[model samples]
Target: MTLDPQRLLRDLFDTAIAAAHPRQVLADQLPADRSGRAIVIGAGKAAAAMAQAIEEAWEGELSGLVVTRYGHGADCTRIEVVEAAHPVPDDAGERVARRVLELVSNLEESDRVIFLLSGGGSSLLALPAEGISLSDKQAINKALLRSGAHIGEMNCVRKHLSAIKGGRLAKACWPATVYTYAISDVPGDQATVIASGPTVADPTTSAQALEILARYGIEIPENVRAWLNDPRSETVKPGDPCLSRSHFQLIARPQQSLDAAAHRVRAAGLTPLILGDLEGEAREVAKVHAGIARQIALHGQPIEPPCVILSGGETTVTVRGNGRGGRNAEFLLGLTEALNGLPGVYALAGDTDGIDGSEDNAGALMTPDSLERAAACGVSAAERLADNDGYGFFAALDDLIVTGPTRTNVNDFRAILVLERHTDDH
Candidate 1:
């Protein structure tokens, strides 16, 4: 059967998104009704949908606020959904952060807080620590993004610089039972790292956060510096009593999305293989992907023709030049180069949130002839890689995938589709 590559790719993308949709998956996980007054709070691309899910599923007196990235808010009744900036914190984020903290502070022992945490929450819940301002945190966050630090490292600094993160929000709901439902966007699904672990115990220290800042050459304001120097400014540590009544539950994750995509691939008359979820360094990951594709093309050791290899996880990019790129773009450019016009191999890599490293494109698509097409358009794959402008290269070819506000983030989704070649073009 002849395969329509575009339609197949679109179907796979839809599958990934469907696997992580809060509206479809969140309701079943929440408690039917809490023993006390229930308040719903959340942050991330999926925050609004998560709120809607709670309102529809939980039969209780629910009241609270949820903050999501701009353009990701969903329609809801009891839960107040607020739109704010992401990747970088803004005034709207700061305002909501303060308000959420305030809401938690007045909770009584008979009350319960239902926290819906997800990716991008760290930036959305941006209440600067006592002496720090939102602008200060924003600057530091920007620097961290360009510094090649992984999400975990960046969030560590964020937790220390915020008044609402690092379990501080949970601390405020001291007398209340805080129940957290999270969508894991970080590698390993570390509870403490997801959304800066607003309701989980922090194993990091102010000194550690300060060290990360120092490594990135980020200058902290005098007040922030003083706070870091003082041991009393520490975030909630392991065994902190303030978190004694809290519970964290992971509702969705990258592996589940990858598995779902693989299932669809098999159902479409192809063998499905998962290439593992955890990965690092976009270029390196691309090289590994290319090697696997090459093996399938030549020896067919791992699998035969008509197969799809899937993977999910966050990858890092070391920014050495000024380029309109992101980790997803970098991976695509590298994959395109390695394929070198090989026949019948197509691949797609994208951030599940529909945004690739703050760029307009979710990710880029690479066909077997991607390099040739790029060359014909006067776009050199090697040069684009050097400039760190993969996004620009793909944009010029109109190969960038644009999905506005998916309202969910599960890190990156990668798929390589191999079809039987009628002719030996290799």
Candidate 2:
């Protein structure tokens, strides 16, 4: 009960990250080595870590490549761990992705392909469809990101425009069994939506992808539009013979991480109310969380004080301004604004991958005096939030939580700590 709120919340966040680390979860989910060679191809924040785990556990010929966000790489002797751009595709990603296709292509039935997938895979595996340039994909990625499209919607568009995603990777390894190990960062953990389901059958269609783009008002070149209209652009669907040998399993998930954090909360003598892996617009979600925290603190209708409200999942942000912040930072800022300096309340929001929205920091923290502290520095929480500059806002107050790449991703982790009720107005 006497634990420092900051330390306690940070401890909880650490617990969640550890629970989802590839080293902790990938080893168990790895399928028994297939009869032949083991070729690992993966992309995401955890791809390199997953490869490292495979090298430690497997007793066979291991070879292949994986692409991760720059600085998220792990050392692997056999499997090459390549780093690339994320939230935006770059030449490095494109180069590595082509290499991955070559590695998996022409594989025999006796060979096994272990495809590691996690958050950021969509951008890390940046193979644009035929006639679609990398810059084109880059532009679309930026637009979708700024348009506030949910992961699924953005991925739907990505799937149709990618040569490697949406089951194409599995198809490239046709005749060879594909074993996909994934760390879930997407809401609902749908394999088809995670990293655009590189190795799993995509139920989403090209038209759906086009519709998503249109719904978001994303403009595309005529060539890209024509590709979507073509039948060949459609992703491999369920029951496709190419994916007959494909198998998938979730190695780690946001909910499991949240559950781990919740366990830590209980051990601290605080109640843990976990809001399931939820997703939506970042600020909007923060507003809802603030409401729950206020209710518990003021009315105690749902839970008493000295409790932590935990939630996890990916949230989107519609970029209306040129601001420097990720969704988690934005969420923290939004929560701070909504709380209106409610006493005895503290919160931390971060991404398990250690980076949020192109920012170096994992996220930021918000204490009861968060707004006041910002005000003292001539920083207006309302103004910063309006500018979508959560990183800048928190940076000024020195509240940004900077955890260099954790090398694993389970999406966003948020905690609202309500220690006591300060408002007496009923």
Candidate 3:
């Protein structure tokens, strides 16, 4: 039976996404309702869907608000959902950030604040510190995205410059019992890093945030820099009374999603080798994956042919070119070049959130004939890549995967299927 690579890859992606859906993972993680009011407050790509799940599962009275990326919101009768900008903050996000603070502020001991945090929450909950303006925050955030800093490092800086991030939101909840349900998007799934750890105690200090900024050469406004230098601008640290009432739960993660895809690969009679959730610069990471694929095809070291390699985790792009693509596209473009259209190997790289960077497509796919197809279509793969135009390269061939807003994020999903070597070839 001839294997349908595209169908299989899409199925694997779908399976990974289904595994992390809030409805499937959240019901069991929710804390039992107490005597006080249950307030649901959150911000992320999946906040609305998570809020909807809470509304369906909770038996007691629950009311509050959550902010998600524009077009990522789900329908919820209660627990109002507000849509805002992602990857960058806007006035809507800032307004909702204030509202979230207000909802949890001055809460009683009996009150319960449930925070549904996922990837992209950091940007969605954009409340600059006292000395910093929103414009300053926006400028810094735009710089950070283009600066190629990893999520942890970017969020480290974000935590110190914000009023509500890095456990300050938990501090605002005060005596209320805070239950935080997180969908992990960062490497190692550190509870304190996802969505900038709004409800969890942050271990990253202001000094570290300053160091990261310096390391990345990201300049901040004068007031913002002064604020970071001040000790009072530090985020909530460990063992603080503000965090005493907080309970953090990791409901879903990248590894779990990868495992789901791995299972589907096995069911399809392909050896599933999960290359354990990689994290690095996107282009460099792609070259590494390409090297592995070549090794498998040549000597069959690591894992033999007819095997499928799967990986998940976020990758960064330095944004050197005026290209129209996100990290995933850049990764795939790098992979395509490294492979040189090697026969019997096909791959796909996509952001699980259904949007790769600011592009309309999730990511792109590459087949053994990808380069040939690009050439045939008068698209110079090498030149496009040099210009950091992965979207244009893939779009020319109509190979971009456009799944509009999966509503949940577990970082990037990547799959490479290596078929058996042909005896007639080489």
**Clash count per candidate:** 0, 0, 0
Quick one: best lDDT, which candidate? 2
After the best TM-score superposition of candidate 1, give how far the Cα of residue 327 lies from its true spot, in angstroms. Answer: 1.8
Off by over 4 Å in 1: 34-36, 421-426
Regions of model 3 farther than 4 Å from truth: 32-36, 422-426
For model 2, the run of ten residues with the poorest summed lDDT: 28-37
Tens digit of per-residue lDDT, candidate 2, span 1-426: 367999988999899999999889977776664345688889999898989998988887888899999999988999988899997999999999999999888889988888888899999999999999999999998888889888888888999999999989999999998889999998899999899998888888888988999998999999999999999999988899998899999889898999999999999999999998887889999999999998998889598888999999888898887779999999999999999998999999999999988989998888899888888999998888889999999999998999999999999999999998756732
Models sorted by lDDT, best on top: 2, 3, 1
Q: How close is candidate 3 to the true structure, as a TM-score?
A: 0.98
Of models 1 and 2, which has the larger TM-score?
2
Model 3 lDDT at residue 201: 81
